[model samples]
Target: MGVFTKFGVRLLLALVLLCSCSIGYESDIDYSLMPVKQGDKWGYINAKGEYIINPQFDGANVFTDNGLARVWVGDKCGFINKKCEYVIAPQYSSATDFFEGKAWTVKPKGAPVLIDTKGRSCFTLKNVRTVYNYSGGLAVVVDDNEMFRAINTAGETVFELSGPAFVTNFVDGLAAVQNMDRLFGYVDKNGKAVINSQFYGADFFLNGKAIVRADDMYGVVNKEGKYVINPQFAEMQQDYNKFLIKIGEQYGWCDERGKIIINPQFENAFPFFGANLAAIKMGEQWGYVNKEGKITVNPQFQFALPFIGKVAWVKSADKWGLIDEDGKFVVNPQFNDVLCSYRLFIPVRNYVVSEYFDVEGIISWINMMLDGNKVDGMTVTQTTISGFRKKYNLGEKGVSVEKKYSRDMSYEIYANGTFYENVSDGWWGTTTKQLPNARLDYVTIQLKLKDNENTRPLYDAVINALGGNNGKRGSGQYVKVKASPGIVTIYVSDKQIKDILNDNLGWSNY
Candidate 1:
């Protein structure tokens, strides 16, 4: 029983037999036992919507991580699991999803191949021709007549990227491709071009900037294709890390050195500048401003978001909560419908960015505890555990990660502890409270100092700009600040505090 407890008892017996044909299903945001019915033929329902797998399928799919699912039926596709079982065998009309285990189908128009969830196609490609999805291990073909290339299921190629004409999907390590005159460019999976190809239109690089359209307007570059800020703007967006461009449409934020420093009058705007805060929208309403643009989360939400870390996510009377990146409300809007779900399982501390500021620094340690505290000396404890996995990434603590840094130091503690102690200087863990005047104190440290050798490598330039594979947790890697075989530490039952709470949780970004 425990395939999610027989999938929560066949999803409580398929939502008590599809609560009357799943009538319009909308418990409010998070819609998907899926079974929307009517259109594109999708299928599968049960969170009381019943049907379990019925939708008939002409196209559409989901379920994997072993819970198979390829779907399609008539023209092929295959896979399905979670006791809906077919295990793989639907054949192929085209398919997708399986990730690290492989998946890609295609037959009707033919070109894709790479199979494995047991439908076999192996890695064909009939000369490539069209396919996307698959990252880091590479995948993004398109040759035999269409022309794009990016192989790696052993077919090798890793970078071909023909004339662009359309590409996108790479995100961050960059991938916008397009040409034949539609302009725009960005490659870099070895197809090289980093920022080359030129930009007539482009977007997606965020933090380090990128958003170009140039001469016709829109500006900012930095991912090395250089341009610094110029273009001019009419519209642009990078989100979260900032860069909300736009000019004729009225908006501002320049500082990668082209100057604007966030002024253009904003009818809508976003972009970063030494950071003081920002989220403007003006007239009809939208709030959050500072850096002089003024406003600051007062526009009153019907929808809002653009803050991360300090918090943001508005909407009001209709319900949706959280406000802080300075707008304050903390958690006010009241839940009627909200889902910000960001938990790479939370973990950020392990500074190795050397230049010697005494080897590590970015400390804010301010615990008085309680009112909701949670920050155990962590080098990692990963938690989002609220109301038992509240379904954001389908919860169950989904997305807990394990990457141990080589650079990039960020830790912001808030304590509530349960258990964790993995000593290794960088992992003594933190946050495990229950003290109403009891006794349980903690300390944590993360150091960044480089010149002892590698020096400010910026996470080794983010692992060579995401071709990834930084792998280095070894060679005299020292942090020796707090975590040690410590000194006086003892624990007795609850399976040694549930094996130190499964070695301090997972998923982290900071």
Candidate 2:
């Protein structure tokens, strides 16, 4: 099973799992059905924004080349076909996207295993600390002994590195490895060091060359370890046949032989995208520049992204929108954020900056409760069960309120929302002592966790909004209650209610 830390939980969570392979593996992507958010629920939509699947799943991912997408049901994850039918039931505690007809999955309290699209276990991986996505017919794994090795789809160890060496996933038939000397080099799939560990830094091969750092400068090296471009630039990156090089404080473009194609002048720039136009920053705004260094698009937007096909996503006035190659607004700036997958722009509202969780709206609602203010036209401490029912008309809205009696003559009201939705579950309670006109003393909201990543930003944002990690307040303190492995709950009350909702749930200041 994977271990969890305060901030390091699910460190292996990745947004994109497929990589380029040279071993004739299928790598085509399906862009017909893209994941979109509709009022806390996730569903699939076409490029024209028509719902192909209704908003129901707790979470949704893009359909892979194999015509299957991963969807979440409550806490367990499963795979679904393009028709929104389950090909694999929601059972795995953790799972990865299918690549080349195979995926890696971990069941509850079980070791990791490789499964095919039909959900049949190909083989089990024992004592593996970490497993990366497969590339070039092999996947990299870190063993319990902290050693790196590569395993094929059949679960056989193809090669294992000796000594204290760190390696990366294969790309372009080569993987970068760092030797005991702390220097980087290239190694083939057969565990042979093709290039000596002599550079301060090295990157995976792209096209036929790679960017390497030596003598505190960047250059390009070919497969034969020969310098195609000598080390001289401060930094370098490859884009197609062009190279984006930075010198001192300016960015420009260079050719395969280190010839200056565009003079280094822009403050910041991205690699060339569609139509050979690159986004470059000037002053405090961003625009587009052609290969000839001509300003094609005027600098005006607060932020801009590379053109994917015919349009690109840009930010203005803190809102994201889509723009055509001519810099005209193709879509108005109304969404809180936008995500791009396979050249499709997906608009999302109330989005958090983290890739894993989207709970900005949930946090904002919780903050209102903590402030003892009105939330959704209802105040936490002053709202009674009867008043709440009257205000929202739960029956009319088709929302069922579950009632439970406690041993202390107190009753609790439990309500469940859409699975993995903004507010997954909610709780309200009152004791007989305050009966007839009883008011709520506490309110709790739970948010579902689909997967995990570097949650430091989300954690820090919540802490800052709730008066820091100490959970200080004027009338009451906020507590972060740990629920199941895939759930997080926030509690706001006039006084501590940890004992009332006791399931031995751990609590900590926000």
Candidate 3:
């Protein structure tokens, strides 16, 4: 989805705050140093409780390497240094950081244009609609005609390719692109068709090979676009070039040679190679494995994230915590929401910065889950998600919920505030619940809310209302729930969010 478009729909979506861990424990993060929201914006305050930058901007983008930032001033884009200097004037509509010394930006409603450290337009990027950050010697741009092309450091089209096609930039020497026949293939930097357009799908070349799909079967090919392994698996998906495929929905990873590095016993597996670790799922839990396919961290997390910086997130029951690479609890999965930290700075207009960072925490988990299912680097809601919450002491609760949805539905566990949907409502649901008392709160609920025609998105509907996404929910601009809270009070902005907690709970009215 286009970043701004998603941002638009989400602008009104509610934010949530989950109390995953106990309040205090020594953390590398000075709890006092985490950014704070001042009314409608996030501001930087040191442990001394002083605003490093005045609490003013609408949002703040995470700082980057140069001690500079991209902040939005009103609707214009600009850059600022840590000293709070507006180094790059806020004049454009949107902007990104400097890479190889040049940043890509766009005028309001305009295509992305390149600017050097001096902030001069490399050229008037006349027709392209969207762009990617400059990387690996090229930045992909989509023209007015919707063709994908690349530009080099000199602000010249080093290469160009036509579409209806993918904007996936070349990784290594190969990029994934669709052909005239609409089948996906790999292309070399010289625009040569290194891999034939024979696969129904293919990911960019990574390490040395790419996974190609024809019909529903999968296989591997080397950088030269040669079939290193013929298509055979019933299903295969690529992660940074390595393959994670299924044999009857069981997943494993394989090298370009089709050698299964991680065996096919996992219910779910990821090709995210970190340190020497990989993540795999079995039953309802997640664990870590080494390149040798040895189970390193036993499947224990309710849902796990690929390890980054030796810390991977794990969930046991209703809480998520962090485990180090050695499978020891580093930051135990106890915080209701966990946020990854970024520490560099960049130049941004004041308004953009205000709009960016203030709401980042709430979207972290939703984005993490979406990253796993993203088709290409592009994120969208195409796959259906459904699950059930086992009501305490209810013998047939699971069976009853399953019978309510499509038989193909795959589910994980259910806890308080779990969003369980049937076939009737999709992933962005109109059905959900809040089980503050863990699984003990047995509240059978249904919400059919329509706030602007279609039912307000169910995920955004309830979650937004609950204080799930940093609790930045707009007043009454969400799903009107009619629930029975059993434990913690329903809250919004920490005010015991009471849009539906009335009559029975009688906390407050909407």
Candidate 4:
């Protein structure tokens, strides 16, 4: 997904608040000097929740690294430092966080302007209808024409476009934008349309993919504007990457291509987390499924959640216990309430097991190593032989290898070996070699390429010639590269991903 498409959603939710004082704990709480409310006044507290600055101000904001915090005196706002002395006396009606040595402030009787630490106006815009403080060296400014444009810190226009468009700060090369038609899309920093405003709604790109909504339906799409999962789902869980989808009243699982990996037979479903297994509900019972949609644990619990490490929280007779993937109890059902906290579960009594944290730390350390060198300095080369027996000159029967090349990562297109129609009727685990110091995660996808016209025969022949050792042959497809450890799926044509998969590279076309 592109950045702008996701920004459109946030921009819509921020319009009214931008015109007024920002609300909510994240906007107001100064974590450095935690703001606490007492009756009608606000005070600053330390991490221990003890008052550091007595309740006096009507409102307060987090302290900046420069040692100044925003405080509301009656109806006006000003900057106060830790010594309880006014850095900038309360005079402005509205103010924002300081960035790059300046902050945006709006006077009681004047428009907003960039102010220096000394509370003096440093710069102002002539016809600024709405403006955001500089971020990533650029701020979004709306002009009198209702058009949005990106302006540098010096107030020079970087790019301008005709609107009624809502623009968001660019991150990771793109920002979400909405055009006059009220559709969402993405734009690059140069203000060029990378993805046209078309979707009804969208989200920021993560792991090279994004969730998009169209015609009141949800689905996942790739950066190239192709629907990896078609827009047929009614709802998606918080973790759409796991492909937990809602269809009508039932929930199920799908692959990146929108194919139903698991039938919509569950009453409810939750997205997969650290492990591929997901908590699913059927009637009053809960269980889990691997990514292939096969039941790893039967529907036997009163409630269950996705596995965090090797264990998950499962409820039986209203009591929660920790169970491993094999459905054996690590912690018997005894807790009143047990919720997931990464690798540990928080019991009802305000305590956690120290043993769980030790395991979590080890997992975290291993993950750090895998992320650094998992794919570093790796190479995959596919060799093509003309045919079987011709090279051997023994008149034996076998398919010939055609051509070979080092696999390229820049392109999403490739060739793959296929399965025989009968041999395709099973599920398999897809795992990569354990990188040094890192644990490998696996996801299961259905083996369906044998039904496709372009891949079936070629893959069938390749598998047969290789004597059915998919792992050995597939190793030639992907050389590892350094990146964050965890799967980032990219969907290509059936032929392309299959080619990658035939060589045992972990990719999904579903």
- Candidate 1 vs. true structure, TM-score: 0.26
> Per-residue lDDT for 241-322 in model 4, tens only?
4566778888887766676778887788766643558778778788988877788899999878656446666779876566
| lDDT head-to-head 1 vs 4, winner | 4
In model 3, where is the ten-residue run with the lowest total lDDT? 345-354
Tens digits of per-residue lDDT, candidate 2, 246-347, equal 898888989889999999888877666324577788888999988899998999998876654555567799875667778988666654444334212110
The Cα error of candidate 1 at residue 393, in Å, is 52
lDDT of 3 by residue, 250-299 (tens): 77877656777776888876555334577787887788888778888888
TM-score, prediction 2: 0.59
- Model 4 residue 321 distance off true place after TM-score fit, in angstroms: 26
- The digit string of per-residue lDDT tens for model 1 on 1-510 reads 100111100110101111111111111111233323334466665333344665556654444334565566677767767555677777666566665577666655344667676666676655434566564467666543456676677877766655744445554466667767667778776766666666667654544566667657767777777777677666654433345455676777655555665667767643332235655667866777876666655786655644433554566776645567667675555433322211111110110111122112122121211102232322222333331123223333222222222232222221223333334554676544322222222222222332223223333332232223212123211111111111111121111123334233221123
TM-score of each: 0.26, 0.59, 0.51, 0.43
Better by lDDT, candidate 3 or 2: 2
lDDT of 1 at 452: 26
Highest TM-score: give the candidate number: 2
Instruction: Tell me the number of clashing residue pairs for each predicted model.
Output: 42, 0, 63, 19
lDDT of 1 at 43: 63
